[model samples]
Target chain A: MNPFIDIRNDFPILKQQVYGKPLVYLDNAATTQKPTTVIDALCNYYRQDNANVHRGVHALSERATVNYERTRDDLVGLIHANNRREIVFVRGATEAINLVAQSWGNANVAAGDEIIISAMEHHSNIVPWQWLCERTGATLKIAPMNARGELLMDQFDAMLHARTRLVAVVHQSNALGTINPVAEIIQKSHAVGAKVLLDGAQALAHMAVDVQALDVDFYVTSAHKMYGPTGVGMLYAKEALLEAMPPYQGGGDMIRTVSFERSEYNDLPYKFEAGTPNIAGVIGFGAALRYLQSLGMDAIAKHEQSLLAYATDKAESTGYIRLIGTAKNKASVLSFAVNGVHPHDLGTILDRDGVAIRAGHHCAMPVMKFFGVPATARASFAVYNTKDDVDTLFVAIEQAYAMFS
Target chain B: MFDLRSLYQEVIVDHSKSPRHFGKLDPCTHQADGHNPLCGDQLHVYLHIKNGCIDDLSFEGDGCAISVASASIMSETLKGKTLGEFEALFDRFQQMVTAPVDQPVADDGMGKLTVLAGVREFPSRVKCAILCWHTLKSAMHADSGVAKTE
Candidate 1:
């Protein structure tokens, strides 16, 4: 019996049905279904402590401020960052990357400098570096990956040179389920005197990350991908780096003393968080962290590993199905192609059976181009997913294949 | 509730399986590429027109079953029709698919094309059904010769 079977009951949305069938949600990579704890935290914050944070001196403001700041403290422990001062909350991983690109990139990156990214990065990781390169005349480089979606470490090592400013890559590929060797990547980058930034949007949900242990310069991720509410995520940087980097956006909360002549930036996190942050969303994110802590990340990782193994075996058992991203080390994602059936059509047919899977490039168009497929059906797992969910997924795949054939 | 049979009708499945007029028209009078950026579905609609009337209408590219079937049925229907009739039918087809599921759409003369009316239930697939029509419209208007449904 699966130890995590009863954990499915915590998510109210999972109990519902679609088209008179039980909703077998396999789209965890896109976004996770929030547990009741997260939902209640969001509701309770609005119902009782609905006040702006950090500015007001009243009791309600203090309550809201403490709860919002508590999430930052929680995140510091979650990722094993240096401290709360190293954690700066942003909209999501996209904004966190933009913050690093604009504040840190503009300040440090010069003309003819190099920024290296990998082939399997999502558009969010790719576009910001492109914009920074365009702004600063820096050359953008890409480290290629093999057919199995594993990054070429030798090629990556060769690309790192004296002028390489930042090496930003995905910690875990959303399109393929490849988990990159970020620790070794960071070590190589640091050897070349280049700061490393990891887009952990897909990684944090599946595995435990330690920013200090990785010795990464910057790490960014989204809350929604980790069973929390949207519009709240964090960027983790070394305190000295964030201290030196200019403020991302100039606004009320980010400034200490704003006058006609000159204004001083607030502190580490507040300097990056310009506008009023997502208050309730942060509280909900805290609850999500607590929920994950209770379940333990190691257990969740093991559960998802076995689930991925089971799903991969089931996918291969079907003669017509071909699994994409056959990397030796992978995580929660299982992207695959069905013979003679387009992914979008497969998605529709699967939806009829209440089996939801992502069917597209998964925001990694370059990866799709590399694989030479327009799109593949991706069924990513989470803690709540079971072996039964994997079985249902293959059944839905059989239905789709039957229809197309 | 969307019935799978209603959405993927026998006519649609047959057409998608072996699409009619499924190639480029060499020395074509007009052509336009249609792209659904959301799902990466792409197809080119080609037309051979003579005196504002279609001599041949063909399409080539890749898409899902709904889109391919819709394109096939559309190419078969609009073979000899004039540009004016094509526009009129386009309007009717748009109205049929965009209308509420419960509302009745007047058949007028849309025979095989009406099979796509089930797309109204699946909002996400509506673009898949109409991308070819929009591409044909762009081909008619002679814009940049590329259509995108974002």
Candidate 2:
């Protein structure tokens, strides 16, 4: 019996039918389906505690503010962060990376400075640094990945020098499911006096991500990936760095006192957080994290690994499906292609059987270019997915292969 | 609205596997690159236009079955047609694919292009099916530049 299969009932969306068939959602890397707890929390917040946070003196506003700030504190424990002030809330991982790029990156990166990123970074992580390079005249150096989609650590070490200011890399590749050697990257980067920022958007959901243990300077991730509300995520920075860096955007809540001339910025996290926050979303995000904790990360990781291995083996056994991103160490993603068919063709075919999967570059074009394929169909596992879902995927793949070939 | 079999009919698969007018033209006159950045589908439409008549037209790119087949079917139907006729074809094709899924397409001058009528079911794939026509439109009027389906 599968250890994790029993929890599927907790997620009501998984029990529904799609296209006159049972829905087998394997697109976790894109975004996860929410459990009823998260949904109910979001509903309850808007229904009961509906008010603007931080500004209004009303009881609803106080409740909203308390709940909103609670997510930041929850994130501190979730990522093993030291203090609540170290955690900063933003729209999502994309905006968190941009915050680092604009606030910290703008101040540090110079014309001759180097920002080292891996080939497997999402567009969110890649583009912000690329834009920073364009603005600051710094060079964006790429640490190449091997054929199996694993990063070359030796090459990454070689790339780092005194000129390297930051080593921004993904903790796990969304496209390939390759869990990177972030710990080593951080140690080596720090040896050369370069700060490390890990894009933990995928990693946060799949595995146990402890920012303190990793000792990385910055760790960015989103909530929607972890079965939370969309448009709410966290950036974990060391308090010293948070104190040193400038505010990303100039607005309310980020200031101590505003004036015509100048304004003193707020504390560590609030300095980064600007304007009216996503109050209900933040409340929902806290509930999501709590839900994940209740399930236990170790159990979720094991269940997902089993699913990944089972799906990978079954997909290869079909003989028509060619698996991409075959790293020795990987996560819940299984990206593959049919023998003579495009990924989208396979996707449309699978959709007929109500097996939802993501077929694209997965927002990692550089990884696609490295693999020399336009796109790959990915079936990513979540807490609620089971072996039956994997079986359904293979059955659909064989049918699609026959139809396309 | 998205009927799976109707969208991936036998014709789309055949054209995608063995795309007609698949390679680049040697003496290419009017050319424009088309890109569906969201899908990572890129095609370069090559036209051999002379005296308002499409002498020869072909495309070279990598895309989904829908896109590649649409380009193939489009090239096959558009070889001997004049510029005015190509415009009419573009209009009707766009109308057919972009039309609401519930509405039926009136058979104007689309010809075999109606094979692509299924694209209307999948709103996202509509960009893929019509990318070649947009490139063809750019090749007709503009000298040389990329055409984007935004």
Candidate 3:
């Protein structure tokens, strides 16, 4: 019996039809369908406990602050961070990365310093380091990946040196659906005395991540990818490192006190969270984490592994279709190209059939260029997605093939 | 279900698969690059204008069916047209695709290009169908920058 049976009911949006066909949303890598609990959390916060956090003299403020900080506590457990102070909420992974780049990057990196990243990194991870390099005259290095989309550890090892200050790479390739060997990457970077930051935007949604076990210096993820609200994500840093790094922004809650001569900053997480945060989104994200925990990440991973295997086998049977990413260790995402159809055209046909998939560069143009394709159509699965969704995806692929070829 | 036929007409598919004038034109009077970053569709439009008339033109690029077909059809239609005539045709083609779907587009002057009016139904794809024409317009004006359909 399928354990995920009737799980689709939890996501109210899944019941809707698109173009008169049942909506088979396969774009989980892009963003997930929010569960009813997450939606209710959003509504409940606004309907009852809507107030500014961290500065509440009133009852509503205390309730709002309690709920908002509860997410930080949930995140500490979600990623196995050492403490609540280690988890700072930002807008999303992009903002989280930018915060690290500006705060820690400005303080630590300087001329002749090296920052290493993988070729499969999304533009968010790449651009910030480039900006850092441009600002401080630091040199940026790219760790190569093979045709199969797995990172070349030997090449990466060779690139690392004492000059390599930071090694930032995606925990999972959103474009290729490859789960990189992050543990090995971390250990190797540490041997060379380089700090590592994992772009956990895709990883947290599909797998169990323990930052303490990984011993990663920094980790960032978006809540939306994990069936939570957008514009709210968390950054996990070691307490010592976050303490030493300069604050990312300055405003109301981030500071302890201000005077004409100087202003004192707040402690740990609050120091980084400048200005008004996404109070409701954070509350919704807390609910999202609870929802995922209720299902158990291990069970979810096991279910998604089987689904990915099923989808891979089905895609392989199509002799003309080419799977873009064939890493030995991959999950959730199935990026592919039909023999004659451009990804954009295939995407359009699939949408007409109500099988929504992500097509094009997927914000990883370097990966596309490496694979020698202009773009690829990606069908990523989530917990609510079933084998039936995989079947619908293949049917749409055939329809696109028939129309284009 | 929305019929794929409305979007992917037989001619559009044919042109996309076997695009006409699908290469660069050397010794061209003017040219401009075109790119749609959203889908990664990119193309170069080249024109050889003599006495203010398009003497020869060609394009080379990778794009979706709507874009490749639109460009292929445009290449064939504008072969002997003057600069002024190209502008008028561009206006008519632009109007046909951008106008309200309920409003009927006149087919009298559009010829084969009328097939692209189907894009009015898919707003996201309207940019794909117009990328090459925008590039061509840039080429006509001798603009050196890449024309983008955002």
Candidate 4:
């Protein structure tokens, strides 16, 4: 397959029209658009295999159970987890992190125990640990970053002490597009017997992730950001941790038996997934993974890298456009602010021209405060994005500058 | 190159570049701050009311063209109106922006605010356009003075 030429055909939404112009969607960091295969999988599941799993005595139930379990196997393959039992489904990355924080952090972390996180973490990663620290009397320590948005390795090393219980870091920053050294982070945390959880919400779709090789204790990702359905995500934890931690919720599927005297819990992954799951969404997520696998992550990464380089060159040459998030190792995101033009106004003008870029903190307010700006105009790329899209952005930015100047 | 004329019309750009009353009122009686955190647009509104009528009004903040222009025109229109008239105008403004129309024009007394009648076309930006008005209303009803900072 010609990586760039062929893959754009799979996503039907790429052909959409916004304000009478062809849509140039560069908001993949927010949520990805679905491909035909994922949409078809959703429609097929509801049309043919729509039934409650595990308990019903009907054929549809049996089919649903098989397909749902197949999704678990797909995730196991995708992340290269030790076993299928390590994968637990949740609402999204936020809920998955909350589950670990509330269940595991509450149980293990004690007063004065240190939980380390980086400055680059999204609010989802930061707020949960803050809540846990407040509830458990644990202290939250931050691993600071340098001026260029790169994590300060020396600072991270200094922050890790014997009291450090867990180190949570983002695999790729949603706002800055920085590809963090999670393999190094896992190695360092493990050296001090601290567990590591990498927020793969932005990383999973853009890079190749192998949980087994990285030896990460826990990893989380959201489906909506991966061209799959929303309200469905995966959490990969070490099998031992899953067995030791208490279940996050209690309901029908997570129980083995219940009586007035005592109640027995269900097995591994089901213990974490407490209710009738988002069956259709899970099926679609599996299909999205299959679609990605077919395209090959290495090819997708290469295509996106080229697009990023092209965009960076275009924005730099345009003059008066100050690009933010210029980390050494970054993904295909171009965040910038034009001279003398507010990001909100630039976003408005671009939207009128059928170019969709996110204009705000990108849900990483701490990063915005770090940069000393209230907001930025971010144009993030995906599998379907092309050089023409970047050209459109450059043209719109030039017009914005001309209007203000 | 893309054309900025459709979205940043001359009137809209004019208001954004040279916004009227784009500063704070010292020792102001009524002041409120408005924000649209989603887009990071902010407006600080200040009004001096005397005898239930607007004696003076001013604004200060950072926002898109539509938002700044809306605030500028809103402040200009609100300059001599009574408190009751301001409330009525707020309702009319809300209706004009939120309601569906085919090529709606800003025929209301508020000049250059008519430029923002184009804002009704972009549903997401309606919040940006109306943020200043929301701040004004909150300022009008505050016990001391409400500041809606986000």
Of the candidates shown, which would achieve the greatest DockQ relative to the real structure? 3
TM-score of chain A of 3: 0.99
lDDT of 4 at B63: 79
lDDT of 3 by residue, A1-405 (tens): 469888899999999999889999999999999999999999999999999998879999999999999999999988999999999999999999999999999999999999999999999999999999999999999999998999999999999999999999999989988899999989989999999999999999888999999999999999999999999998999999999999989888999999989999999889998898999999999999999999999999999999999999999998988999999999999999899898998898899888999999999999999998889999998999999999999988888888776
Docking class of 3: medium
The full ranking of all candidates by DockQ, starting with the best, is 3, 1, 2, 4
Model 4 residue runs over 4 Å out of place are B1-7, B103-108, B143-150
Residues B20-139 of candidate 2 have per-residue lDDT tens digits of: 998989897788899887677899999998888999999999999999999999999999998888888888888889888788898666788888898887777899898899988898
Of 2 and 3, the candidate ahead on DockQ is 3
| CA lDDT, candidate 2, residue A70 | 86
- DockQ score, prediction 4: 0.54
Cα lDDT tens digits for candidate 4, A155-196: 899888789999999999988889998889899999998999
Clashing residue pairs in candidate 2 (N, C-alpha, C atoms within 3 angstroms): none
User: Which consecutive 10 residues in model 4 chain A have the weakest lDDT in total?
Assistant: A1-10
Where model 1 places Cα greater than 4 Å from the true spot, the runs are none
Error of 1 at B119 (Å): 1.5
- The best candidate in terms of TM-score: 3
What i-RMS does each candidate reach, in Å?
Answer: 2.2, 2.8, 1.4, 2.3
What DockQ does each candidate score versus the true complex, computed on alpha carbons? 0.68, 0.59, 0.77, 0.54
Greater lDDT among 2 and 4 belongs to 2
Question: What ranking emerges by TM-score with the best candidate at the front?
Answer: 3, 1, 2, 4
